[model samples]
Target chain A: MHSPHFSVIFSLDALTGALFLLTAIGVVATRQVLASLQLFIAQSLLLSLSALLLGIALGSPHLFAVAGITIATKTVLIPWLLRHTVSVEVYRTREIDRVLNIPSSLLIAAFLVVIAYAIANPLLGAVDLPFARINLPLGLAAMFLGVFTVVARREAVPQLLGLLALENGVFFAGVAIVPELPVIAELAAAVDVPVVALVVGLLTRQIHKRIGSTSVGRLAALRER
Target chain B: MELAAILLIPALASGFALLPTNRHFAAPMTVAATVVVFILASAVAVRTTHTGRVDALGQWLTCDGLGALILALVALVAMTAALFSWGYIRIRAGHSERRKEQHYYALYNLFVMSLLAVPILANVALMWVAIELTTLLSAFLVGFEDTPEALEAAWKYVVLTTLGAVLALLGFLILYWGSQVAGYAPFTWAGLVEAAPRMPPALLWPAFLLILVGFGTKVGLVPMHTWLPDAHSQAPASICALLSGVETTTVLYVILRLFPVVGGTPSLDARPWFVGFGLLSVAIATLLLIYVRDFKRMFAFSTVEHMGIILVAAGLGGAEAHLGAAYQMAGHAIAKSFCFFAAGAVATVFGTQEIAAIRGLVRFAPLTAVALTAGAFAITGAPPFAVFISEFLIFKAGIASGQYLTIALLATFVVIAFCAVMFHINRMTFSTPLGSVPATALPLSCSATLAVAAIPLVVIGIYVPPALQDLLHAAATAMGG
Candidate 1:
């Protein structure tokens, strides 16, 4: 019975890992800001599901609460806030202007994924923990991809989403390693997320009002004299 | 009595100053509070001189050799800054509202309270949180003016440092994980040091690296130091003094704490990385300082230079080097705070920060001109100042450790930075005033603060107290002498 339960977790972990990779690729390849936001949300949702399944398999009720918070906040509240604050009109009009083209980003993302897998394979093989070795690298790759999105995107919303994605990656990585991190620390982190979201939201409103666009390039006006 | 007063006075005064009443009361109240804290801290240092240590609240707050030195520096400078802000803020009283003045004092107290907490906290995790709280509280202070530029600098500062802190958090987590492997129960400085010998090198190495890079950013090491100049230049001068002087040093103290744990573990030499980053920061900041246009920013860049100096000192990795680093931390706190106070006064008089714009300061404000010149000379490693002694000690340590090239490079950059800074200081002080802005007389508090800050810069150059010597020796010993 324990073995079957482990097998179920293993499959869900694999699916979660694959979804993370896909979302990362989508983040890199997609040039439209709205599409990238959507992909990021999808990635966050998958992370919640993975955390929830792992919690059930491990019989850790706290992780279930973590999962619920992750979903409601990351997948729902944050994206909705981003969408509303960064109005749909702006999202539809502005495409993600990248320094590197889509093909190049995809190629770079592929290279990164390969490097991640190569690094994780031997390391994870030595580790005794279940699913950590695989899940860790996937989470890292998603983080790297999130960073790429942030670097690639010119628009503020996409960059903001990229930051959120990066946090999600870190969260997933933390879950994979120590699924039962002290509840106090976990709650602190959870509380921090929405507060940051709200702050960023306020900043976004200010940015829009001031510049009429939320591009990183224009924000460089305050550089050192 | 000492610890309680150091913590509570600021906390209570800050609470009182936060009341939305009179604009007149804020500055004086803050100054009084800081003075009391400074006096208490000095007494603590004096008491520790005889007893060898001061432990408080069941060892949750401590004044060992290094912490005593830090506490003394923090108290003295914070007190002086508080004094200076009295005159500084008074100049802006008519321009600002009653409420804004109150808010400034409130944030000012909070910032100082958090900085004081960093050196005294016993738990390493608690220390990290306190450092983070310092960032949060000071973020408002940095953006106190709320101008577009100030806002932007504050945002950059908060974002970059917060990111660095998150990495530091991960590093702490990794350390906790490693400690668990080593059969440790609680994660505290004492606990970690006790279990240090058994921890695996793999975990220790990665954790140390993460922490070095993480806290290194807060300390304004190169590449990660982009926010320092902007934020420092934008903040009120008193706060700038705290930010650059004591605040960065407190973060560096945490890195210093980790050295014993990581340095003791064989097969991991963290020195090379520290030296590399130190040299990089020094060289970059030296070159940049030459071209810096803003006088305030020129001072800010010097902070990066000094931090690099301290890092290189620490990287030298010996008892003497550790002592040099400790001395450097103390001296820089005094010298840098004086520099900022003077710079703030000059900025107030000239109504601008541009180096090219402000000239003939001596004719305009002779006292400020003298203070700026003296501060510039002291900070640029001139003789008869504490920074010179500390830098000399560092170079000597570097040479003794066979890091001849590092010492030579450090010297070259120091020279370059000196020339860059003196060039501007000379121009600003000696040259004819560009405009007809009269030399407005400053209030008594401002001159007193500058005098207090300046006296140490001059005195420590010529003499090292026995207690300070003992404290530095002990701190060095704590670093694994």
Candidate 2:
């Protein structure tokens, strides 16, 4: 009996997409700076995995290229850049400061997820792509979570992770809708994301050196009277 | 070839500046490179004025009417800001910090190169990359002073704008998806326009909203503008000129480029969104202008005000309002850059940016006083300045279009912003000097920059050259006028 490749890929891709959204939530919920970074790495890997499966299902070589670029840049180059740019201590930091407590942040995060799916529902109904049924809402939900994480987190490293997760969410949605324009995804992963990490990481080191802490949300020296 | 050369020159200059060289080498090298870029960009603007397009690599690197206008403004600001930086950087760093100054020039050239490439790059994806690079390359420049506050501002600037860029990236990818569904096409603005009508409104609306709100953040629209005042106020004045002057406009150009595409699609209207966000930004900036104590921060908020006016003009519709929008973009760029230079000069002279601290500049520092008052007059829509002409045209266009409520709100905000700006400048100009402040002489290069930047600010208000008027016409028509 021939295997049902369509259902197989759909279920497998749905699984990967769920894991991807989970990692995005993990970033928002985690209190440790190191845990958020790990969650971001896991999220990036899930993104590349989804890209790989979407490439096979869509039969697009362009998405395969995007997958490779995501792994090479996001999981590998970004972490390496962060390691050298920011000190070792920032990664070792356990008590990552955040603007809101975990339950409150997660509550708002849950609200954001519902709103995201509501926003994506109209969009998905307007199009008839099968894979979009899984990716669009999940990716949008993850993006909402990522934005929440950025708003809630107080430290530089966690905040940067939240921003990265936001990007990963976009790309996760992107693979289903724009497998043809792999150039944008590739350029974003290889050129844009790593630079964001390197620059923000370097800035974090400078702030730590000058301000004696990486809790950038605590920075209030530049306010108006 | 010219477009290619324009991008090439600054990339080369950035490399040259990083070479282990004397303190004197970097600034001049950067200035010469921007001069070449300015001349080449002006040629492109002139050619586009006559022929309406210039293509370097078929579709990937091309310039249309609006692109040429933005290119010219960015290049002009870069050249003048480079010249200003020559003396400003030297005075700020003294003889001891040669390495830091060299690094500053290197970053400055790369930053300008990215700004220059934004208009010229035809591929939307690559253009986003260039915009992202503008932030990364300039982060260090924004924090160049090494103060805790400067670093904080830079930290916020990079993180926030990069986040905005990512959100816009998703929007762009969605737009690409829309194009693919309508019919496979290249992912350029022109290609999107061709595909817009057939594209699903479902996809079009989300892409438009995402990009508008996303890049709207970088454009420093009201609610998304918290990072702007800090970054613009903290950066070195020369960098502030580029940041406040063209960087915001350059990104806004990306959002504006979509007007035609969105306008082309059925069941989609971008004007209400534009007018709503535009008027809100203007209103908020006016209120903030009243209480702004730091002169640099005041100029930064004024920038927020001008961006809103341009958005309103764009939303007001018709060729006249669109032309006014184009004029306002040009006028704001020149006047805003000059205002920062005036602020820089005041900072240099009295060693303070607080509006309350410096007084009797007219008596104690006559040259500084003149520059400050003239800058205020030019930027606040006083007579015989580009901003005045542009705002008047915008209002006339708004009235013609019969959007009285929108026009009324905008007019009220502009007037209040005017009074707020003038009051602060007046106190700083003629009021008595507070506590015996010593007014140091402005550096020769900075003074020369003021004279040079003043030319267009003053001339364009009173007269618009025929070729430039044609250029503005082309730019407006390209905006769906």
Candidate 3:
């Protein structure tokens, strides 16, 4: 197999990494739940692209397998499961409110990106990959943003999307740093995600069915009366 | 051969649980599976005491001193939980009874399978996968009723624990990378511990803290333990036993496995973190216990309190403390399972979990009232019970090591928790009958399981069986005693 020059692969991967970060922001910033979820799909797609590029760049075949798993599980399977579980009526009734306003959240997210770069900077010199120093920080930044989204969003679906984004960030960092991470760990995690998605989706459906809304804040009534 | 048998039993049980059998078969099948597992697991525990370790498929599956002890505990509780499920499902409401029973049994087996996998697996990565699977499987069981409360509990459980697991995954990856840097390939627990001294402090310390925080969530450590009470309270009683008694310990098993590795690091101090988190958790859970109104939630908080006690013992870093921690684990598992079973029986009889509504249980269901009282006594570390012995050992170890302030604080909280636990159970069991109390027949399964659990609580209190004592001593050594 003919291999592309190092610079070309690196540029493409860097672009995908950039797009990955942008989609994570899109998820946190979007007002509509469906749009937020759709942005997660976009984030997963970029994650798969980055993984594919890293696989080709590093000459590691397992990253290709990881890329495939990412696409199949995160991109295709999870989105389909979620869309099927959520009714279209949910869209009209639910525009997810943020605990922090969007612009402020985005500002905090950008600050988190700076912290990520700082944390990633020192660790970069120790690893083997040269491109990892560039890609890993963005991955870390995305993770920070995703966690912010989980804590800042009140709805079940948006919070779920936030968790997915966090995972995508972790996966990107995993490939950048330790591409040979055991296939078993990756595969087991891949298989486990769909189960988590299915369970969480079913649970969301149950919450909506009984409570008529998936606002997690409204669940405060369970305490002793 | 025994290791293979131990793993295969649960795997096969999970498969059989999925079969399209009549609803009548679910309980019996589940009971049979758990019984077989208990027997095999006990045999393996005994053999590990004599044999020192059991390995199969090379290092893919291994049961060492610690693993055997934990595996035995898992089986013991799973058996009780399975039996408890028989009674729990019989009286449960608000669902298609047959389908719900079938699904409950199926998920119960799968959950047990993952719990089994946690201790027996040799590789850290595989162990993490197993622990993650336990959460994935049990979160559904937590929401099996599909009520709003159950769903809310399940959602919080999945999101919180899975987030914790992700951090743990990051920790494991870094450990794996560090292993490679140190020239170890497989990243098994043994390999990681061996290579830990050479691992750079930058990698070792962060990985250790990440794992502590990550698995700490699964262990239901404070701040991260918000999901525990809700999930445990909302779940069916039988499932609560496994989740509280077994799953928490199984995940904490990961942290314990990492302890020696972190100890092997040359420059990092690990004890303060354990002690800090342990003290924090105990403090929070103790305060919550005084105000807990829901009986199941009270027990759930007690589980948190017990986890803290065990962690404190481990953090003491004395040989006696490690042994005490092992004994605490066994005692807590038995006592907690018994309490949950009795509470389930009482809830079934009274049709409510509110402690206020449960006045004069003795007048209504005398046997469960007796079991509940005994369980509370045993769990609170009353004399002539297993927890008393373990807690005493911990106190002795703490004093010997000159942790006087921590011990004083521990004693204060223990007394408060004891009074609080006893107060609730006493009011529930012996309070005046507020109205016409029905004389409902307790389920045979509930009574039988509690009877079985009572033996260990009483026996281990007075005398630890020689075989079990051997296993506990060996386990203590495995943890660096």
The TM-score that candidate 3 achieves is 0.96
Of candidates 3 and 1, the better by lDDT: 3
Tell me the tens digit of each residue's lDDT in model 2 across B364-393.
Answer: 778878988998898889999988888899
Off by over 4 Å in 3: A1-4, A91-93, A125-128, B93-96
Native contact fraction per model: 0.03, 0.79, 0.51
Residue B222 in model 2: lDDT = 85
Worst 10 residues of 1 chain B by lDDT: B89-98
Candidate 1: CAPRI quality band: acceptable
By lDDT rank, best first, the candidates go 2, 3, 1
Off by over 4 Å in 2: A1-4, A182-185
Q: Write the per-residue lDDT of candidate 3 for residues A1-225, one digit (tens) a residue.
A: 326677898888888888888998888788788888889888888888888888888888999999899999988899888878866666555554558788898898889999989887666656556667767788788888888887788888888888888888888888877888888878888987787778778777878888888887557746634
Say which candidate scores most in DockQ.
2
Off by over 4 Å in 1: A1-4, A21-103, A115-127, A154-161, A187-213, A222-225, B1-14, B40-64, B90-96, B438-444
lDDT of residue B271 for candidate 1? 81
Residues B1-481, candidate 3: write the lDDT tens digits.
6667766877777677667877668788888888888898888899888888888887689888889889999999998889877866776733456767777777888889889989988778788888888988888799887778888888888888988988787788778878877885667777888899887777777678889998999899998999899998999999998988888988877788777898897678787787888888999999999999999999999999989998888888878999999999999999988888888888888878898888888877888889999988988889989999999999999999999988898888988999999999999988898898665677788788888878887888999889999999988888877
How many clashing pairs per prediction, in order?
A: 0, 0, 0
